[model samples]
Target: MKLLIVTPHFYPENFKVNDMAFELQKRGHDVSVMTAIPDYPEGRFYKGYGIFKKRRESINGVKVHRSLIIPRHSGSSFWLAMNYLSYTFFASLKSLWFGIAKKYDAIIVHEPSPILVGIPAVIIKKLQKIPVHFWVLDLWPESLTAAGGITNKNIIYPFEKLTKWIYDNCTTLMIGSKGYEKSICNKGDFKDKIEFFPNWVEDSLESQKMIDVPKLPKGFNVVIAGNMGDAQDLPHIMETARMLKGSNIRFNFIGDGRKREYVENYARENGLMNNIFCLGRYPLEAMPAFFAQADILFMALKDTPIFALTVPSRLQAYMSSGKPVVAMINGEGADTIREADCGWSVPAGDSEQLANLLKHLSTLNKDELTQKGANGKEYSRKYYDFTKCINHLEKIIGTGL
Candidate 1:
C-alpha cells in the first residue's frame, strides 16, 4: 500500500510519527511524510532545515515533504497559533498538488495537536478520492483551553467547528486514549468511525545499548524524561522537589521544552538545586541509559478535563523501560498506572501527595521496586508492543473506508 502521512512534527524533531513512517516503509508499504520544518519544543527551526533549504529529503527510504511554517517563538499561544495555521494553509496547498501528482491508497493524519493537520489530509481525500485515516493523539479546542489557556467562547467556537469538520471528513478516527471517544463523539456522530489505537514505545527506546550519563547525580534518582511543557504540570513537580529538599531523593529532569528554563529558574530561585537536577534533552537512543540509572520514573500532567482524558505517550515509554513509575496525574493515565500495578500515582497537582509518595518509594527495598518495574515491563509487552500496534494500524488502513 502506498501511504502518505500528514503530521506537524516528524523526524529530526523526535515524534512517534517518525517511527510509524519507518515501520510502514519497512513493511513494504511506500510511505511519505508531509510535515513542517523541524521546530518543536525549542520553538526554533533545527540547525540544518529552513524554508528554502532541504525542504524535500528522504530519510530511511521514506520520502519527506517539508512545508513552510512560522516557528513557535517562545512557544507563546499566539505564536503556536501561527505555527499551526501556517502549516495548515501551506500543507493544504501542497496537498492539492501532491494529491494530483502522486497517487496513494490512503492518507494518515498523525495529529498530536492542532487538529488542523487533518485539513490537508481531507483536501487530499477530496482530490484523490482516498481514505483519510486520522490518528488523533490530542483533542482540540479542549487543548486550546487546557494547554493554551484560551477561554473565550468567541476564540474557541471556530476551532470547535473546524474540529468537527475534520472529524466528519475522516474515514476513520484512531484515538490514542479510550477516554477520548466520549469527547470526540460529542463533536460528531463518530462512534462508528472511532477506533482505539494507543501509542507504542519507540523501537529505539525498546532496544538501546545503555551508555553512562555521568551528569546524573548519585542519589535516589527520580528521572523525568521527555517534554517539560505546560501540560506536564512542572510547577507541581518542582514543588514536590522543593518539599523533598534535604532528603536523599534527587529529582533528575532529563528532557527540554518551553518550561525547562522556567524549571531551571525556579530551582535556582527557590534554592532547590540540591534536590533538583535539570539534565536537559537527549536523543531517543539515550533514554534507556537514563532510565537505567533511574530509581523511579516520574511523570505528571496538569489538572484539566483534556489532560484527565489523556494517556501521555511517555507513560508507555516509562513502562517499557522496566522502571517503577510514579505519576501525579488524573483519570486515564492514573488508571493505567493502577491497572498495570507498575507504580504509584497521586492526584494531579498535589505536591504534598507526590512528595509523600516519593518518600515512600525511597523506603521500598530494591526487590520490591524491581518487582514493580517487572510488572510494568510485562504489562507493556502484552499491550503496548510496537509490532502488534503497527500490525493493527495496517489492518485499520486496509479496511477503513
Candidate 2:
C-alpha cells in the first residue's frame, strides 16, 4: 500500500514518529511524508536548511516534502500559536497544490493539532476517495483547557463545534491511551472511532549488552526527561527538591522547554542547588543511557481537572527502561501506575508527599526495586507495544480501504 503521512514535526526534528515512518516503509508500504522544515520549540531552521518554499528530498528510502515556516516560536504562547498556524497553513496549501492528485491507499496525519494539515488531508480524501486517519498524540482543546490557558468559554463554543466537525469527519481516530478514548467520546460523538495506538520503543537488549553505559552523578538519582512546560508543574518539582535538599536523593531534569528558565531560577533562589540538577536537553538518541542509569524515573503535570485523562508519552519511555516511576500526578497516570504495580504515584504539587515517596524509594532493596521495574516492563510489553498498535493501524486502514 502507498501512504502519505502528514505532520508538521518529522525527521531531524527529534520526534518519535520519524522512526515510526521508517517502520512503515520497512513493512513494504510506500510511505512518504509531507512536513515543514525542522524547526520546533526552538523556531530556528536547522543549520543546513533555509527558510523558503518547499524542498523535496529522501531520507534513507522514504520520500519527504519539506515546506517553509515562520520559524520564530520557542517558548512564547503567542508565537507558539503562530508557529503552529504557519506550518498548518503552508503544509495544507502544499498538500492541496501537490498531494491532492497523488494516488495513495491512505493518509495518516500526526497530531497534537493536525488541523492545519487536515485541510489538504480532507481535500485529498475527498478528491482521491481514500481514507484519512488522524493519529492523535495529544487530545486538543481539552489539553488547552488542562493547561488553564483557555478561559474564554465564549470562543470555546465555536472551537468546540469545529473540533466536533473534525472528529466526525476523520475516517478513524487513533490515540495513545484508553483514558483518552473515554474523554473524547464523552463529548457525545466520536465514541466508536477512538482506538488505542500505543507508542513503542525499539528493542534495547542489544544496547544493554553492548557496553557499560555512563553512570549518573551519584546517589539515589530520580530523573525527569521530557518537556518542562506549563502543563507540567515543574515549580512543584523544584519545591520537592527543596524539601529533599539535605537528603542523598538527587533529582535530574533532562529536557528543554518554555519553563526551563523559571524552573532553573526557582532552584537557585530556593537553595535547592544541593538536590536538583538541571541538564539541558539531550538529543533523543542519547536519552536511553540516562534512562538506563537512573534509580527511578518521574513524571508530573499540573493539578488540572482535565489531566485526570492524560497519560504522558514519557510514561511509555520510562516503562520501556524497566524502571519504576516516581510519579507526581493524578488520574490516568496514577491509574496506570496502580494497574501495573510499577511504581508509586503521589499527589501532584505536594512537596511533603513527594519527599516521603523519594525517601521511601531510597530505602527499598535492589531486588524489590528490580521487581517493580520488571512489572512496568512487563505491562508495557503486553499493553503498550508499538507493533501491536501498528497492527491495529493496519487493521483500521484495511477497514477503510
In model 1, the clashing pairs are none
The digit string of per-residue lDDT tens for model 1 on 1-401 reads: 89999999998988888889998898888899999999987889999999888899999999999999999999987898899899999999999899789899999999888888888899889899989899999899898889888899998999999999988889899988999999999998999999889899887787758766756787899999988889999988888889988899998889888888899899899988888888888888889988988999999999999999988889989999889999999999999999999999999999998999888888889999999999999999999888888989988998322
Per-residue alpha-carbon lDDT of model 2 for 1-401, expressed as tens digits? 89988888887886767877887888888999988888766668877776643378788788998876777566576776677778778876777775545788899988865344566677667778778888877666676676637778885676666667666668888887677787678665787787667667655521364343345677899988988788889878877788788889988888888888888788788887768787877766567778777899999988986777778778877887788888888888889889999988988878789988888889889888888899998988898777776777788878322
RMSD of each: 1.5, 2.4
Best by lDDT: 1
Can you give the lDDT of residue 336 in candidate 1? 93
Clashing pairs in 2: none
Prediction 2 global C-alpha lDDT: 0.77
